[model samples]
Target: MDDVTRQKILDQIPVIDYIPKENSQAFLYLKRVLHWQQTNSKNAVLVVDDSSAARSHISALLKRRNFTVVTANNGVIALEKLKEHKNIKMVITDLEMPEMNGITLTNEIRKKYTREQLAIIGISGATSGIHSARFIKNGADDFLRKPFCPEEFYCRITQNIESLNNIAKIQHAANTDYLTDLSNRRAFIHNANHRIAEYVKRKVSYCLAVLDVDYFKKVNDNYGHDAGDQILKVLALYMRKHFGGD
Candidate 1:
């Protein structure tokens, strides 16, 4: 960040302290606001290691900071945990462990996980030779050496989690239709059977309409593309607003 941006953030921390301790209401209000950010982040960091002690240590550190943590002893267990809890947005693995060492774990994950799937960080005692580079080549988003500083570890973890979230959002937008903000026809049908089961089980009514846009061809010919685009946006917004916003 530039000097100005850094200075602005530095300024805000001191200002937050200026609020009087006597004002209990203001303190409660601000505290809730800060907690809401943590809640909505919904970030989960999975600490995978053969050692239970290592897993518990990392889990405790993150939990104290308000992030959710999951632990697994081996690669097989890790993948099962991932499937059981789809919101595990990040994974931190220790290399040179038992069955399903870091490389094997990463390879399995990369097979099913796109760039949007999950952010994986590899931590190892062995940093020399190809050990560190192998982790990166096998889809590790970041690498950390053993005996790292607390602050540096926190920074790298935060960066990887944030990066994964942003990439997932972009991929979602690209695959979805902008006008309706829903999956396009092809995307919708990619797993239509799965999506439709809920509606069928609930016995809910749905309507499929063949919309013609009320002479869209003529509208485009008369008003040009910009106006036509605006019409689509307006209609989509109206549909979403009244129809539970998808």
Candidate 2:
């Protein structure tokens, strides 16, 4: 193909325009918003479809929006890709495929991955609402019908990803100490309850110890809060290094 023909075909591809060179105020504002989304998003998405053309189209759309995209021809292939790519946080899957259908795949994935670890969106050309409902019943986080508008597709993806990130943030805050980055009291209690049940059931011998720093308040009052924090951090690090578990 000639250069002009190639350029024309490239322009025909469905891609979002995120650049901010336009002069209009509204366009500039949109550009800024898109920039923020791009910078904040670092998620990898797995796209599973039996149709190569469909895979390419959706992958291009996701890439234009600053997401990392990996394509698999079917759910079996998608599962392998998931094992290989640990960074993948979301999956966009088609319901109809050979070897493994989307519903079956979604069910299998849910057995291993929780909603917090991986988000799944089901897409289908089926016009029936039953298809979307079944996808949700099979563990998909969201569903989109085929022939969807680009705007709607992006909105669904953004909403699901943002929800996952927010959940992770909340879980982190609940489980971790704000100052020491160690497991907080809540996490310790939760874990201890589980361990206690396991030990009682198995009759395993185990021991727990609680440590308190001597004159910690004096250290804070004399050396300052920063020094007290450093001392606590050092103790936590030493404990982690010496008593870490698998």
Candidate 1's residue-wise lDDT over 1-246, tens digit each?
A: 465654565355223222234568868746743653476348777899988877876776576556788899988889999998888888899987777898999989999987677888888877486777898899888888876644467668666766776787887786689765766776667646666787789998765556667799888899998889888888878877786534
> Across residues 125-216, which tens digit of lDDT does each residue of candidate 2 receive?
98788988899999999999998866578778878887888899999998999877889988999999999999999999999988999999
Instruction: Provide the lDDT at 33 for model 2.
Output: 50
Return the TM-score for each candidate structure.
Answer: 0.63, 0.73
- Which ranges of candidate 2 are over 4 A from the true structure? 1-41, 189-215, 224-227, 233-246
